[model samples]
Structure formats: structure tokens, C-alpha cells
Target: MPRSPHRTRMRLAALVFSLTLLLVMTTLGIIPRASSTTTAFSFASAGDTSTLTAGDGLNSLNRLAGSRADFFLGVGDYSYQSSMTGDVWCSQFKAKYSNIEIGPGNHDTGETNDTSGTRSYERYVAGCSFTLSSQVVCGPVAGQCYGKEYYFDYPSVNPIARFIMISPRVFNVTGVCTTTCNAVAKSPCNDTTGCWPYNKNDTHYNWTASAVDSARTTGIKWVVVGMHKVCISAGAESCNIGTNLFNMLVAKKVDLILQGHDHTYERSKQLAFNSACTGFTTNSSYVLYNSSCVVDDGSRGFYTAGGHGFLKYAVSTDRIDIQTDFAGTYQDSFSVVSPTTSLSASFTYSPASPTIGAQVTFTATASGGTSPYSFDWNFGDNSTAQGNPVSHSYTKAGSYNVALTVRDSAAPTPNTQTMTNPVSVSPTPLSLSVSGPSTATTGSPVAFTATASGGTAPYTFAWTATGGSPSSGGGSSFTTTFNAAGTFVVSATVTDANSQTSNASQQIAISAPIPPLSASFTYSPSSPLPVLPVTFTGSATGGTQPYSFTWDFGDGSTATGQSVDHSYLLPGAYTVTLTVTDAGGQTAKAYQTVTVTIL
Candidate 1:
């Protein structure tokens, strides 16, 4: 035992490799912890690989393969040719798809010869390691597992879920008639085999039902049954085998059925069989047995199947969301309402926070009843009912818990209800101010500005000038010109965001023009002129108002009153002049040469 260290290390390495291989074989699904919410699963049916390229199939698989879902289910036919060597390919496929759960299809059994009994298939089945949680017995025969069919539990925190895989060929008990036998004349089955009954009480029926019942007993909330053949489809000859299984599962309240045999993907409404009549078309009548079943009142019993595609089931406690993706596109989807929650109601409101007196606009959303919701608003103000987002003015300020209750047209009671945090109302004073350009000149344009200091939106401005060019403008400031010579007043009225207003006024003066005069002027007649009365005029400058004038002819003639006329006595050269004075008695004079002569 105390051998070389190298030998001990080699032994340990071999043991580790063996354990790793075993782990790989046993646990096919390995997912990281972060991507648990978005689990993806992919499936392919019988004969899909023969016509579809590996790239095409792989592309479809990648699309559905979310990072969380390390598990995948290969429902059926993985190989085109049924030969012993195909098992080698299956092994290769298993190695390649180490993360998937491999299910055996008819082609994997290498039973190409239709007449070669179940010997080859049995050998292949024995070699397969995949196991089911329950076994289905063929007829009353004990220990007869339906081909290689198996069931397993999917350990998810969501409602308990289970999957059932069955071989479509083994369930094909309704034999082709080469000779006539039992019950109806020209029947397909011989007397020993019993006319392959299509009823739910048939042997194959009991076997599948037992398996499902066993799975359900384990507290599985949803049972997803996968097979190669479909009950309702547009292609292929109609087979009552699917019908029998469908009826049995409906009676047992199975959650979902995933099937593919035809090249296209298809889906049917939740279905059940009516005992009133029998036929192959969708018009055949059957008793509705499942809670999710679609009622065919017009005798159209079966809903048409979808195209070649994979079925995805999102299982939850309240409902099962089913989607069918075909050729990389989601072709069909619907939800199966759980019987327990069918009558339950729920509602929600958006933008939860709303200020009081802010008109918190909201939509009352609802589900599980007739539409056109009836709205009731309880503002926690002890005030009664009204419509959604009902505009109510809060007189007093406080935190009030708001509740919205909605009842649909078909609801027996108000099933949808929503509540929000208490709305708060706070009041504050509105204020305003004016800025810039307080004073300006008359006949010259000027501008004044005003601004709101506080409050909310929708504020109004009403400007009234006490006195200015324009006396009043309903805005912030007044712009106008003053024509008269007097003191003018300008004012601006400002309104806050809350529609509160205030006024401010400024006074401006319009000045009159000053007379320019530092000199005086006078007028008189020339000398050597005719002896007629000649008047003299005088003018003075440099004063605001109230000036005096006087006239004096050198011949001892004088006149007054700002300006006066003087008469010439004789025709001789005599100096004529006039003087003017201000109220201050500041005087100035001017003279003109004159001549008094006879004409």
C-alpha cells in the first residue's frame, strides 16, 4: 500500500474520471444558477431528421434552448434508416447532446422489416437505459410495459409536473384486416385479438390511463403526455387510437398532450369525447369531460390540429401556458385556466405615486370576467363610489389611502381590486417678481420684465399700468409712449405659477423743450422817409416764460408791453431801437436805420 507516489496519483485520477462519466450519464441536465427563471426545452418528432437538415434542426433547437434549460427532450425518430448500426448513431447523438434526455423512437429500434415481429425492437429496448416512473400494461397482461415508454418527474418549484413518453407503434393495436372477424362483419381484427375496439375501455386505453393515474397519484399538478400520433390532424388517415387516448386523459383530467407524426405541427382546443355519435370528422359528437375542454355545440366536436412544430408548456400553479412553434416561428398559443382559479379576479394600476389635487389619472385594469369594467373609487375620505381616476377635490390635506375596485359586466361580484399609497396634499403661497428696465423716456420705447417666483403650472399674468404710454397690458409689463409734458408712471403686474398676482409701479417724467436765447432783436423804420407813424417790435431770449419788452425812439418816444409801435414825428435821420427784458430784468437791445421822407 506504501507504493510509489506516482502510482497512488494515477489510481486517484482514474477514479475521478470514472465518477465523472457516471455523473454525465445519470444527470443530463446541468444549468447555471442565474438563469433559473427562463428555462427552455426543445423537442423533435418522428421522421423530422430525415427531411430536415441537421443545421435546420439545430437552429430550431438553439432558438428554444434558453441558457437555463440544460435539459432537452428528443420525442422520436432520430434516424432515417432502421438498422442495427443506427444505435451507434444514437450513442453518438447522446454524446453530442450530453445535456438532453434521449427518448427511443421507432427508428432507433432498427425494425425496418414490418413483418419481423418485436424481436429487434425488444433487444433495442433492453439496451436503452432511460426509465419511466410508472409502467403501462398492455391489456390485462401483467408486466407488459408499453414498448419502451416511460414517465419521469420534473422537479420544479412550480406546481408539480410530470412527463410521459409512449411509443406510437406499440399503441397501434387496430390491425389491418386481411380476413374478416368478430362483432361487425368485415372487421379489421380477428376473433382472438378482439375487434380492436376504439373505445376508452379498450386494452391499450387502460394501460395508458393506468400510467397517467400512477403519475398523478404522486401529487403531479400537470401531466404532459408526448406521443408520435395526433388525435386531430389534417394530413394522414384518421385513427381512432388518438381519440381513445384523448377521451381517457380528458376523463382523468390530464393537463396537456404533445404529439407529432405528420410532418406539420398542430394544436387542438382542450378536448373530450361525446357519446352521442361517432365519426372521423371534427363534427363527431362526444361528451365534454375536462374543465379546459372546448364545447362544440354545433356537433363540431374536435378542434383542428396545428402544423409540424414543437409544443412548449409553461406550467404554473394557476394555469398552463401552451405554445406551438413551427419552422422557427410561434404559430399558436393559449392558456389553460386551472379549475380552482377560473373564477378568481385581479387588478393593477400604473404610475402608483400621485400627488393630491394633482388629478392622478389612472386606468383600472382587470381580468377573469366580462370587460367594460365598472369602476369604484374610495379616496379613504369617507366619500363614496365613482368611475376610474375620478376627479375629486380634497378639501382637507392628509395622507389618504386610495382604493380602486372594478367589476366586469359578467362578474358576479367585484372580483378585481387595487389599492395605492395615501395621496398627500400640501398647500403653499404663490409669489411673483418683476426684473429689469424700471424707467424710460417719453415718445421713446422702453421695456419692463416680470417673473413668477413660486407655485404650480397654468399661471396667469394680468398687467395694469397705473400711468404710462400704454396704461394697461394683461401681461407682465407695459410698453408705451408719453406725448404730454408731465410725470408718467409705469407698472408691471406679475402672476405666479399658481395663478397669484402682484403689482409694482415706477414714475417717469416727460420734459419740455427750453428756448435758446442769449441775444435780443428789434425792428424800426428807416430815416428820410414820409412823416407817418412807424411801429417798432422787440424780442428777447434765455428764459422759461414771462418776459418784458420796451421800445424807445431817439426822438424821445417810448412804448412798452414786450413790444410796441413808435410813430416818426418828422422826416429826418433819427436812431430807432427797442429793448426787451426777462422777469429778472436782464435787458438787451437792437436798432435799425430809418428815413422819414414825403412821397
Candidate 2:
């Protein structure tokens, strides 16, 4: 029966649609993915395993399974037996841990009498490809990964760590050195047999460098390298991993290096190449010739030669702690922490003392830890903002402790640093009070002073007056003379350094000057007797002109005019008083005594 073309087209269309949907889901992160953050996680690692059917291998597997690890790393040499296939090892491993990563060991490769297909290396690749199906392969060829060299990021989505797996000298074959080949492939032909020197320009070296550089550029907090052969170890194993690779790893500041080949477990101290030694020989017989060349002589653990144990790693954003569980007993432990986790934060604000309702800018800076960093600001006024360089305004005057917290993009737990600074906000003080005489006579100099406070210092005063000479003046104090008598107003405006202005005004009264006025009177009746009229005369001078007078007799008689007569009806003695007024409203008084007797 011929297949229906239309049906076939529909099926193809459906397949395309499904694939597109899946892609969209993955891009949007709607699909479940792995996570590798600064968050803490644990894993187990080991190499050179015997078949887990029985014996020490089973015990080690049991210990690793009980480790409560998120994943397991098979460093190399699975099943020790060259005839054992990789799938068989994975079958036993999968029962314990579903997530696993593997790097090939010498026994797993075509070394000695073992051939490529027969060795467990090829089988391990196939098994791991299935177990870790989502692993990203970056080998020289497409899908040609996990067998010899490859790299993967944990918790693939937004990973915080990268694991680089490499096989340097796993294969021993007859081949000329090439830049694209592993160390053994580039090994020097020593008389066509026996010993072979390392080649610096090899596939593993170049790939490792590129991988490490990429991880750094991508801001991966941790870079871990895993292999099956030891380079610089306290164990009896030769430095088969090559010298150039070791130095490169150290120079790159790789967080940790995991390898397993020797039957005994060993760990090297934090070592740094002094550049004293050019290269190290890979032969087992080679030993350190100079004590100065050794930075740290690390310890070794001979867990009964073929230890039945695995290494457990507790990893965090900044540190990785490792411990060995061997023969049901705790053996070795060490810690490897990244120095980049030291984080410090600081912030600076403009306008040291801000005024209420004015904007203040805060810029934050951080040192150490991985970036792209995040800034969180607590403006100290119950307000919050995020991001570097933020602005805020205070609604009231007070002292606020502004806090800035900077967090770096580290996984499992980002490095956080908090810093606090006191910010003082002052109330607006750009007001002024005009003070001077409220009443001044004509031609009198009246000092008008403007007193200002707050809103930044260095206040300037501008004075304006009405009905006064020199009506405008500057500075805090101004003096002006009033030329005419009237009710006038004095005003001053003060401006502070911040360009804030305030105004004040005072009403003043001005009058024309008055001259001295005096009043004198002469009485004709200085010795007048009772029942007689007393005559008085008054005159005045000074003050504004045209004087008027009034005279009063002490015995209750009063008279008006410049001169007046007053008589006491009955009195032994009588007093007469006269008052004079000038045009300017000035007044003066005079008094006279008269003796009055009965006629």
C-alpha cells in the first residue's frame, strides 16, 4: 500500500510544530532544567573501581550511595578489569545515583593488550551519554564527546559552575605528535620504544585552556577539572597527566582538580609552580630533586592499598570541602575555597547635608566577588531602591543611616556586603526677619537688619524701603534716612547659598523734626489781692511757629489766649499756669505764684 502524501505532509507539519513548541518552552525556561547556583550541593567522586558485584568495589559503591549526593563523578578506571564494559559499571552506579559524569582512565582505554571497542572507555561513553542525556558536547567532532574529552555545566540553566573532563595519556599507540592529539599521541618516540616525553602543544592542553578561559569569561564562579591520571600527587602514580597541563591549571586558578589512577588515595596541598622547574618527567621513577621546587609536600593515605571508598564533596558558592569515606571509616579531609569571594561594599552621596524635599544621589561601589553585581539601597527613611547610583529625597529633617547592600552573581549563595552611612537632612532655613526702628524722625538714619538662617550658609540680604533716602541696600544690615514724615515700610529679601530666598518686611513711622519750644509768662497780679483780676502774658519760641497759649488760676478759673487774666474768688495764695503750643505740635508750660489777700 502506498503511503498517503497528504497524511505524510500533515505528520511532518505536526512534528515541526511540536519541535517549535519545545524550543519556545526551553527558551522561555518553562521546561524543568538543572540548577547550579551559589547554593550548596554535594557530590561523590572516585576512580579505579572494581566490579560492584562483590568485594571492595561494592563496599565503596555502598558508601558513595549513602553519601546523599546530588550527583556522582566517575574520575576514571571503572571496573579495573580491562574486559569490563562501561555499561556494566553504569548499571551498578545508576542503582545508587541517576546523575553521573565520567572521565576515561587508562584501563578503560586501549592500553596494553586492550583494543578500542573492547575497552570500557567506549562503553562508558555510551552509557554516560544515555545517563546524562542533556550533556552538552564540545569535542572536535559532533557528538564525539564523553569518550575522551568533554565539558559540562551543572544545573545547566544559569549554571554557576563548569566541569571540564579530559583524557590526556589514556591511550598508548604508535603515532606522530600532532597539535590536535592528546598527550600520548604527541609523545616523543624514544628510539621507537619505551619512554616517551610529553608534548606541550596537544589537544588536551589547548582544549583545557579554551575551556577555562570560556568559563571565566562567562562568569562561572567555579571551574573544576577532572581526569583519570595524576599529575602532581603524593601517590606512586607517575605524572602521566603532563606538566604543561598542571601549570596551566594552576595559572588559571582552577578551583579544584580531581584525578584517580593510583590504588591509594592522595591529595596535594595548594601548590604553585615557582617556575624553577621547566617540566617534570612522567616516569614513576622520577622524584623531586630540589627541595626549593616543592611548595608543599602533601600527605598520602594508603587505605590498605586498594581502598574501598570514595570522595565526598560539599560544594558552595565560595568553597568546596572534600572528605574520604574508606573502609567504613572517615579518612582524609581538605577544603578548597576561592579567594574571589571576599566582597566589600561602599557608597557615596552628593550634598553631604541634604535639605528636605531636595534630591540626593547615592552611588555604590563593590570590590571582590564575581560580577555583574547587584545593588540594593535602603535610603534610611523607610524607603528602598535597587540598582547602582540611585536618588532619593527626604520628606522630613533627621539623621538617617543609609545602608547599601551589594550582592555578586555567585552560585548557591551570592556574596553579600552591606555598608551604612549617616545622612543628615536639614529643614529649610532660608527665612529672614527685618528688624529696625519702627518709628524714625525725618533725616534720621534707621538701621534695617536682615537676619537669615538655614538652607546653606552665606546669606545675602537685599533691603528696600519706601519714603527713605538710599532706598535699596545690600548685605545683612542696611541703614537709610527718612526724608519725610509718613508711615513707611521696610522690606528685606534674603538668599542663601542654595539659591533659596525669603522675604521680610517691617512698617515704620517717620515724622518731621520738631525744634525746642519754651513758654514764659509774666503776671501783673503777682501780689494781687482777693476779689481782684489777675492778668497773665505768655510767649514761646522754637519748634514750628504760631504758638497759642492758655492760662489757669489755681482757684479753678481758666482762660485762653497768649495772655489771660484769672481771679481767685477767695484765697490766701493763688497759682497761675500757662501752656504754649507750636505748629509742629510741640508744647511747653510755665507757672507763676500770686499772693491774694482780702481787700
Clashes of 2: 11
Model 2 — TM-score against the truth?
Answer: 0.49
lDDT of 2 by residue, 1-599 (tens): 11122111000001111222222232233332223336367777777666576655566667667779878877776654445567877777778667777777655554542343423355677676535434665654344466556788875666667888776656532222212223443445342321222345555467778898899999888887777776644446556766666656655666677777655443323233346656433334222223234444344432223234677777777566666676534344545544453788999998887899889999998888888899999988789999878999998888999999999988878989999999999887677788888888999888877888767778888889866789898988899998888899889998878788999999999888766999898888567776677778888878778888887777777889986766667767666788888887888999877787765
Candidate 1 per-residue lDDT, tens place, 1-599, comes to 12121111001001111122222222233211211223233222223343222444444444445423334455544444334333454454444343444344433433222323333434333333343333222334344344345566665343266667655442222222222211222334333332233355566456667767886786767676665444544345244234555655555656665544344333222223334534323324333322122222344312343223344455454454544444433354444544322223333333344443444454555565545667777767887566755565555546777677666665366356454546665443455665545344456665666665435555666655554547667665546666566765565656555456666565666654454444455455434355555656556667544767666677887777755666665766666666666666566667766666767
- Tell me the lDDT of candidate 1: 0.47
For candidate 2, the 10 contiguous residues with the lowest summed lDDT are 7-16
Candidate 2 runs further than 4 Å off: 1-39, 116-120, 130-134, 172-203, 266-292, 295-306, 328-330, 340-345, 348-357, 366-599
Candidate 2, position 544, lDDT: 77
Best by TM-score: 2
Q: Which 10 consecutive residues of model 1 have the lowest summed lDDT?
A: 7-16
Candidate 1: residue 87 Cα off by (Å):
1.4
Local accuracy by lDDT, each model: 0.47, 0.66
